[model samples]
Target: MLKKTRVAVFVSGGGSNLEALLQSEVSGGMPFGEIALVVSNTQGAYALERANNHGVEGVCIPSRGNSGFEEELQALLMARHIDIIVLAGFLAILSADFVGKWPERIINIHPSLIPSFCGKGFYGLKVHEAALERGVTLTGATVHLVNEIPDGGRILLQKAVEIRPDDTAKTLQQRVMEQAEWVLLPQATAQLCQELSEKLSEGV
Candidate 1:
């Protein structure tokens, strides 16, 4: 029997992506694991509300005056016994120290194809807006390993959609979000879980 590893989702927004993941898990289409927790940096992140709605253990630790929040964040994650960390709309750049501890165990989803409209000041609709300004004929989402520099992770999977001449940022973003459901999150998480299970069997 394949063991189901536990996953912890980190989010900083509405958590629509997280919802997709939860639905995927519920559908039993994934090859491995299920969400064990939903951790958020925002106390009131709607993501947290979604977590509650799904009965997922929700841990909210906003930066909230704590200058050493990164260390606290790391400690919290460790205590949760998280096997994998999924950055679902998690905006804050985790400290390099924390990232080093997790290594490829961390993953994130970006709105635009990386190595393009990604970097400081690029996120959410800002990325979609840039794609519109550049008149990109094709646009999509990328799922990748998390790194120190935002959006610099090695690409695990990416899916592109042709942008119509009339495509606005909102329309393009809606399209990308739809693709995000079909392309990035579900398949990647299943692959990650399978890989983790294989490594365990190999005693790596």
Candidate 2:
């Protein structure tokens, strides 16, 4: 049997996808994973609340003036023996120091198909509004390796949602979230797990 991967999820929102990941892993009868830690950059983030409710240990690493962000983040991951990192709705651009340290070990779920309506200032409902204004028939999510600057990395997987004629930013955002939490989130984590597995098997 393959050993379960110890994954750490970082979030800055309601952590709906984190909830989805936990649910899927528990019910899927799969024995290849566990969420070791859920870290939040903001003290008030609801993701932390979710983590607390689930009894998974949670930590808050403040980005305030860069006091100890990298040190604290690295320490937490190391202490957790984290094998994978997932960024779910985490808005801050992680430091190059951190990304360089982790490389492809980190993943982010972007709110658009990427290269279409992604990058700095295109997060959250802003992305939905941009897609709608551009009249694109499709707008969705992209899960990719995290790099310095927003959306600045290789594309891993993308799944799209249709832009209806009556789409408001809120309406479109709802669809994007649904696509994210229900499908892309779990699939992305699984894909990363497979990639890491292959990387190990190749070296054997």
Pick the lDDT winner: 1
10 residues in a row with least lDDT, candidate 2: 24-33
RMSD of 1: 1.5
Relative to the true structure, candidate 2 has a C-alpha RMSD (angstroms) of: 1.9
lDDT, candidate 1, equals: 0.83
TM-score of each: 0.93, 0.91
- Candidate 2, residue 28: how far the Cα is off, in Å: 2.0
lDDT of 2 by residue, 96-183 (tens): 8888888788988888887988887888888888898888998888888887867888888888788899989999898888865457
On TM-score, the candidate that comes out on top is 1
lDDT of each: 0.83, 0.82
Clashing residue pairs in candidate 1 (N, C-alpha, C atoms within 3 angstroms): none
Q: After superposition, how far is residue 51 of candidate 2 from its true place, in Å?
A: 1.5
